[model samples]
Target: MKKRTAAAAMFTVAILATAAYAAHPGADYIKENGYKGPETCEECHPGKAKAFLDTVHWKHASKVTNVDGLDPKKEYGMQNRIYVMCNGNDIVNNLKEIPKNPETGKTKFSGCNTCHPGDHLNDVGSKGAEAEKAIDCLVCHSTAYDFRKRKPMKDDKGRVVMGQDRSKEAALAIGKPTAKNCMVCHEAAGGGVIVKRGFSFTKETDAHAAKGMVCVDCHKAKDHKIPTGTDPNNWANDGVRLSCADVSCHGASPHKDADLNRHTAKVACQTCHIPRTGGAFAKDFTVWAQNPDKFYEPTTLKLEANESSPVYAWYNGTVANTPHFIGPKGSKKDGKSKIYPFKIFQGKAFYNKKTGELLSMDFAPPMANGNTRAGVESAARTLGMKNPEQVAKEAVPGWQTIYFASSHLVTKTRALSCANCHAPNGVLNFKELGYSDKEVVKLTSPELFFNKVAAKMKEDW
Candidate 1:
């Protein structure tokens, strides 16, 4: 009798789980047919597949039309993008030979495609029918996509790399992308949770997420091209600027206070909305070097962790990007400049002293045997360095910095108190922000507040 009762409980639990899954919109459609692959999706979404192929997400390359100091016509993306994070791209011929995770003890493929929506490795230029096959439709559209079902598989070159799940259930489970679909890759970018964007949108951080709004609601895509507003770290820009004052969302004058509304002319919404960031998961600095175990692990230093206030800067929607540095191109005196909040990322990268160029360190090569010299050589060759050996030989580690906009983790109703910026020990350093002593005094004075309010009231009257 006890054995029968146990069996009944197990059956009941299975039924409930199945019922929940069956509630998905596409689940009922499975009764008509089964999923074959991306071909199955193409049967219905023919235009969508073609449209997505043209996007930055599919090509991983873009004609950077909006960034300053870089050739706008020259296409740039992950193919040649380098960052101190991950010690640059970790591409290796044999993906299976890459080192296992110290924490998980599982050998996993950690390439750029690990977060990409496509199944093909580095097939950035794939188009038409070829791109449709290369694209992993279920990865983004299906609620039933299972990571467990995606085991390591062999690529066309017989190299063992990560695989995808296009099972019948995954195809049948196709639905509009939710936060879960987007966060699967975004949350894990730059190696771990909230690592890239110190405080990404979450239920605890963003008012939008708290209200169950997904990323796509704000970052709406047209032909899969999403707007990324002036991130110095990013290599591509589609020129579709995003603003808080959009007609569909917040209007020009959102605040009840006239003073606050006037401030919008010289201050971005994010400066006040994103009061603080990091939230204990942020890493402000990372130093990359071969570990004692011969595996290259980034030594992270959390200089500003656990809900730290942002570094305020003036921005004019332009950036200075080069091989060694990337930063905003706005000054306090710039008439077009507006105050913005930013999370500063600083890191160390290997630089070739001879060529005066930064060397990319392929983490996979060093991870296998801890030979950082070889990793540097591999990266130098990939970057078309004529003398890879000489470049690697003369490489010296140095620090670089990039500032990312703090545009998310927004509080709808919460903002920095006047004291947070106006007090003697305020968050912003007026001198560092290019303010003269006299200007700082006037800016921080209590009389400034009353004067502004009085002026606003007088104008209203």
Candidate 2:
């Protein structure tokens, strides 16, 4: 029995050794050859090779040649200096000192290729050819875990095994283009260069980070083609459409006029609502509050109603002159001649009095206090009036005598504001209206409810 067990053990050891050899073919090759460079990959994928060369990434790593000499006032000026930002004790601190090759004392260029080593065509060359297409399929798509080196597990056959198949299977199990892939470069922990100002690099920094969302969620395409640009190719690109307002994740639209499907085609959602400065992207609302100049002020109006006095209404200074109400001619039933009270009931009274005489009382106000210009025009047409002035004259007396003020001025008045139509229930927040904010901190603050949106967005992505 002891002799039989020894023979079985010897057979298992032989099987395990053979399995290890098969799984680690590349490992031995890499150690001996030391990265032949991305040129080998280009042999299979040439289209991606050409596209990557045209990007800013390739330009950063391209060695200065006879045709690429420096010019003080030209494209090769101080702007071309590759100085990495040095944050003391920060993730980027390692980058402060110029990158040096351990084998050869040479400074490495600051470019995508630095992190994406698989894109280099010649590992030993001063400048490597762009191999983005090759890298995408090989490096980015592959798992980073060291699978080949892992110990093997035996099968029911009683044979020793290195589990090479299991390692490859495990790598393939992870989803592609996930936030996990993006965080590999975009996060500070992942050797990211983009530093967020006033905000630390944490899971909270990227709302999607916590929800396991990958970078590809928002930036869908592998290429750098933005949908809004003038490039005709962009029209054909099948990337994800991200809207600033009414995204499924936010649970509400931030745009005063949220049109989900159409808005993304017309504008970039992040241009206004997301804060890009200092590496932060739409973390909070404090940034918006501090940078009023970055965004467009929304049209606003305030209406105050009272039983005894003329209803008061005002709009933003630019829109204050728009007429809100009108009265019928000589219909001074309220004992006020030529002057109409800014009340819906008052207008109703004038309408009733004038319509009592005519077979059809077609008198209506030029516009209501909170109505938009287009809305007012539609209402006038519905009431059979040719213009706002005709309705104004017939519906109220002294309608033009009403004072105009900024919507902000009516803070003390008990009235409904323009938000009723423009931003009801926070559905139409002004930030989503393609307005950018310079104050990133304020725009991304918790008080602004940005996290709530981030959380929702992460889930949706």
Candidate 3:
């Protein structure tokens, strides 16, 4: 009788543990039978699959509702967007021209596709049921995600396309996304590790990361739609701004001192928190001039370190998304504007002399044959511009600037002191920020300004 009771207790404990494991997102639903495609997930979570299809994660585009100058009714994202990187061309845009691997006889997916979750080579070919089947659900959900398993696979129509890990372990390892899930793509963006976003989840850099808080703690996704702040180059989470001052976070008045809290109204949290970006290898400047040796490579590539100074600017949330011009929408005079930190990146691209628009070239093709001119013409043709060769001929190298908000790599302990911006030899250019000489002098003189606020405040400083 004693032995039977002990056996029963052990069985109950094992059953309870199994139930607890099933509580994770999609864990219970996804059977541990085998590694099927998104169709396997759709069998149980049809609505989830359908909802995810419309999200920016899958489409890589969203309605242009946030950008200041863009038509709100139209859609914008990686498919149609341009940036200072890669000669202004979005990744996988020119799939028709991308050459097939001689050995495989299969057109290998572009390097950018590694981070992307879709099975299709490019967005153009992915459509309808095919698109649904292409969604790699494991990439976001599975803790055991094996990115190395991503390789060429046959689609429904027997066409070979890029596919992600379909391992049984990945299928069974489904759960809510952790920081590792988000960082897998975010960390390795722009061709290399820790190159693009400069978001290395470490205690030394970020307070939130120090506490083992995941990105979703702040990003706060609702039905797979993650929220991010104002960024002209990124259209993913437009209009959905996440900030440290959110009521759930530090709130309106985070500081103990009333005088310091007043600055919160005019200064963004990131202004002091995120001192710099372009960590280690982020390309600060690139010139897309033709290279004789490597036709695909940029003429000049200048990388910046983690301590690189950010470009200070005034921001009222809205950013211009005009193809030819992109920047923040506010000046110092704007009542709603707050002082913000930005990473100002510059690149040289082929400018159309007649239309004043920059031409996006398909440099991927030229990599195979060492033909820069052909790459330019191929890109011009893809744009459907008249006289592709003529457009390439008339194109001239010109400078383009892109401003990205420095909102990550936050360090409360290492936050800038008041003297860093208020001293005589301060980092900020007061005149450039629209302050008059008199106002600048008064602002710069921290001692004189703090004296009138409170005697204790001056002593504390």
Model 1, range 230-321, lDDT digits (tens) per residue?
A: 66567665556677888777888989987789888877888878878772222212233555554565556553322666788888877776
Candidate 2, superposed: residue stretches over 4 Å from native: 1-46, 61-79, 82-113, 119-138, 145-175, 189-205, 209-212, 222-461
The true-versus-predicted C-alpha distance at residue 237 of model 1, in Å, is 3.3
| TM-score of candidate 3 to 2 decimals | 0.84
Q: Candidates' TM-scores? A: 0.83, 0.29, 0.84
Ranking by lDDT: 1, 3, 2
Best by TM-score: 3
On TM-score, the stronger of 1 and 3 is 3
Residue 325 of candidate 1: its Cα lDDT? 57
lDDT of each: 0.68, 0.29, 0.68
Better of 1 and 2 by lDDT: 1
- RMSD of candidate 2 to true structure, Å: 27.1
Choose 2 or 3, whichever is better by TM-score.
3
lDDT of 3 at 440: 91
Which regions of candidate 1 deviate over 4 angstroms? 1-29, 90-96, 99-108, 155-157, 279-295, 303-306, 450-461
